[model samples]
Target: MPLWWHLMKSVPSLQIVLHRIAWSAVIVGAFLFWRDGRGWLKRALSKPNTWWMLALSGVLIGFNWGLYIWAVNAGHVVESSLGYFINPLLNVLLGVVFLRERLGRVQWMSVAIATLGVAWLTFRFGQLPWIALALAASFALYGLIRKLAAVDSIDGLGVEGAYLFLPVVAMLVWSETHGQGGFFDGYGVAMSVMLVVSGALTALPLVGFAYAVRRVPLSIIGLLQYVAPTMQFLIGVFVFHEAFDRDRAVGFAFIWIALAIFAIDGALRARRANARAPLVPAASPR
Candidate 1:
């Protein structure tokens, strides 16, 4: 999606965001209808709190998307990568604070270490890592809202997309009037098609994430979340060739060490849990 956004440099960032959301809404909305039909939609829409929660989450995710796109397009891919890297830790903090969940001692230590890593990065940069911080905070809050709401993944997304649809449409209309719309202008069929397909690119992974979070513990989800940022970081360093001096490496090293500790702790607990489970004897035939 970032690559596509970069290619569409002629288009306004807001316009790109709107186009992606509009298409994603159509794709996700269709999937919801196919899976549950009108019944589930009606049930989901009936609750007022659902709407309120979805509305707030919608704004958060929308901002996250826009900022991330801008970051990638503005040659800040490394910073964008850093944002996702911080997101899982932020989720842990949110879980403890808002969800009233208790972290293990090791987990707390890991958080402290990660905090130090972020602090190091901030000191080195001489400015707040606002992009990383914003992405982490927004996504963590979005997940918390969805978890508390206890809505089905597809249903929640459909509602969230609905909330965004109107404003996106208005933006598109404004772009068209201003003669800056990329969709109909001479941007070529390939570009237009790519822009349209951005919807699926945006929505599918989110559907999977939303579904998984409902079924899994947030901690487990957090551990798994590192895969995305790690890949992004590799892409930024190797592919985009972003600066990675010794000072930045030291900061990242701390984060990686923190992750290693967190992963080992989780493995130990899982193993202990498995060992403690009592095996059941087979029932004798009557």
Candidate 2:
């Protein structure tokens, strides 16, 4: 979806984000109403703590989206890919620390190798990859919040969208009145359509992800998640023709190797577990 930004050269990244938030609210809100009417929303609202957690998650995801859009447009796509590449490792570490989950020997080694990759990138780049780090950290936190929250994924997304909806709409209106709105500034019909569809593109994947996460094994999801960042990296290098000099290549190689080890170990563990016990269907998230 970030590649879609290439067609939106004239649009401000922030404006795109506003559109994403506002329209995602519309889509998810409509779905919730159609599915369960207002009961789910009312139940969510009655609990202040739930909404607060969702609101914070909303802020983190919004930040992640805005930064990612800007980075893709500003020629930092490769670095953006690196952020996602680091995210699973970060998630594992977060789990170990926050949830008291224990990491096996292989997992720890994988984390150590990934850390070395980031260190190498930092050393060779002569500075920290702040964009990458921020994206990873924000998204990791978002995932953590969502995992801890009691609400269903779509409903949680709806709540988050609701939290941002009015403010984002007001901002868009302000931008339009000030003649700074991309949707109304003669950017053409195609740009307007892209902006509108961005919301569906955002919500659908998340909904699908929520559905899949329940049905799929964690190790399989870990492997599948790499598909996205891998495509982004390929697009950056092959399509955008971004630089992939020797030093950057070396750094990425370390990360790739670490991911390989991590994935292999997870898959093996999962296979053994399945063999030892019959597979049980996971309960749907509520």
Candidate 3:
């Protein structure tokens, strides 16, 4: 269903995202409460320290989503893809600067290559890749907030979303209050049903990512992270009928190569980590 909606966005972008998220949130929220019962809600909402964390991440996620939606709608998906392509490198940079972690020479080169790719893209286009930059900045900040929040991924998403969801839903409603929104008018009833589905749609990928985050090696996670964006990039050009000029294609190719270097670095790090230790299972022994 998520893939369906994503593909459907060829006609319209933000509207589809809005509808999908609205639906996904409903189901995801219900599942959270059901699976964890009141425990989940209490954990997410009650901690004062967590509240600030949630709010910050919530706002950042909202910004990220909204911009991505807008970018797709405006036929800027190529740039948007560039943003996500840049994200991993930005993640590494954040680790160094914010977490005070050391970066090896290879990591520095990976960053430099990514930087060159962005500069090349910008120079070829004669403008900054705002869509990509905005996506990278907001998402990088979200990652920082997530790490510092120190809450379980599931609980944190719900909490931060709880903060932002209302205003977003309200605004969507308000935008159409004068009359049914162009997007919302037809099958108003059906769309509403779908909107309730948004919560689940919203939660599932995170759940997939969360599962992947824990179960998969970071090298694998880094590799898998590219899947969704790659799909988006293809859908943009092939499915949505967005243009992919020669220069833009070259830009993306370079980003992909740079990402390959980044992923290799991660794999090497993971390999060394495994070599240095018991390679103990994450699960504790009874």
Candidate 4:
């Protein structure tokens, strides 16, 4: 996805974002209609509170997407990767503060270590890593909103798409009519296809994430989630050749250590809990 975004660097971030939202709505709407018919969507939208929550979450995810597209295209992929690396720890902190959940000593220590990493990055860079921080904060908050909203993942996603679909489509139409659109403004057919496919690329991971969240333990998912940022980090350093000198490496090392601590601690706890209780069936996707 980052690679695709990087390839579309010439396109405005807002333009790409609008295409993403518009096409995702079309794709998800089609899927929903196929899976459960129109009645399902009507039922999902009937809950006024859920609709509002989806609206709020839509804004958050939209902001995250826009910032991420801009960051990747602006050659800040490493910094953006740092954001995801920091996100799990931020999720833990958010849970503690907002969900009133308690963290173990290990969890607190990990959070502290991650904070130190961010602090060091800020100190060395001579400015706050605002890109990383913003991405992490926005995504973490989006997760929180999704967690609190009592709806299926697909339903919530569909709702979010619906909320932004028409306005975004309108914006795209206006942009194209005004000769400022990137979609067909001499970018070639390949670029146009890529732009449309971005929606499916965006929606598939989310749907898979929702499926996994239902069936897999949160601890396991937490561990698996690292694969993405790890790949992004590698792509940034090796593929894009972004600057990652020793100083930045040191900061990333601190966060990596913190993540190791966090992952290990969570794994041990999950192991103990499973040992103490009989296994329950995983939740159905529906």
Clashes of 4: 0
How many steric clashes does model 1 contain? Answer: 0
Candidate 1 lDDT tens digits, 172-236:
88888888786786567887787788888999998888778778975577578777787777777
Runs with alpha carbons beyond 4 Å of true place in candidate 3: 1-22, 45-48, 180-193, 279-286
Q: Score every model by TM-score.
A: 0.91, 0.94, 0.85, 0.94
Estimate, for each residue in 193-242, the C-alpha lDDT of model 4 and write its tens digit.
98899999999888888788888888878889999999999999999999
RMSD of each: 2.5, 3.9, 3.5, 3.6
Instruction: Mark the regions of model 4 whose C-alpha exceeds 4 Å error after superposition.
Output: 46-48, 278-286
Q: Residue 216: error of model 2 in Å?
A: 2.8
* Top lDDT hit: 4
State the RMSD for candidate 2.
3.9
Question: Model 4, 235: alpha-carbon shift in Å?
Answer: 0.3
Candidate 2 vs candidate 3, TM-score winner: 2
Candidate 2 per-residue C-alpha lDDT over 45-116 given as tens digits, one digit per residue, 9 for 90 to 100:
665578789999999999999999999999888999999999999999999988899999999999999989
Worst 10 residues of 1 by lDDT: 1-10
Alpha carbon lDDT of residue 229, candidate 4?
Answer: 93
- Model 2: residues with Cα > 4 Å off, grouped in runs: 45-48, 278-286
**Residue 191 CA error for candidate 1 (Å)?**
1.4
lDDT against the true structure, each candidate: 0.82, 0.89, 0.74, 0.90
lDDT of 2: 0.89
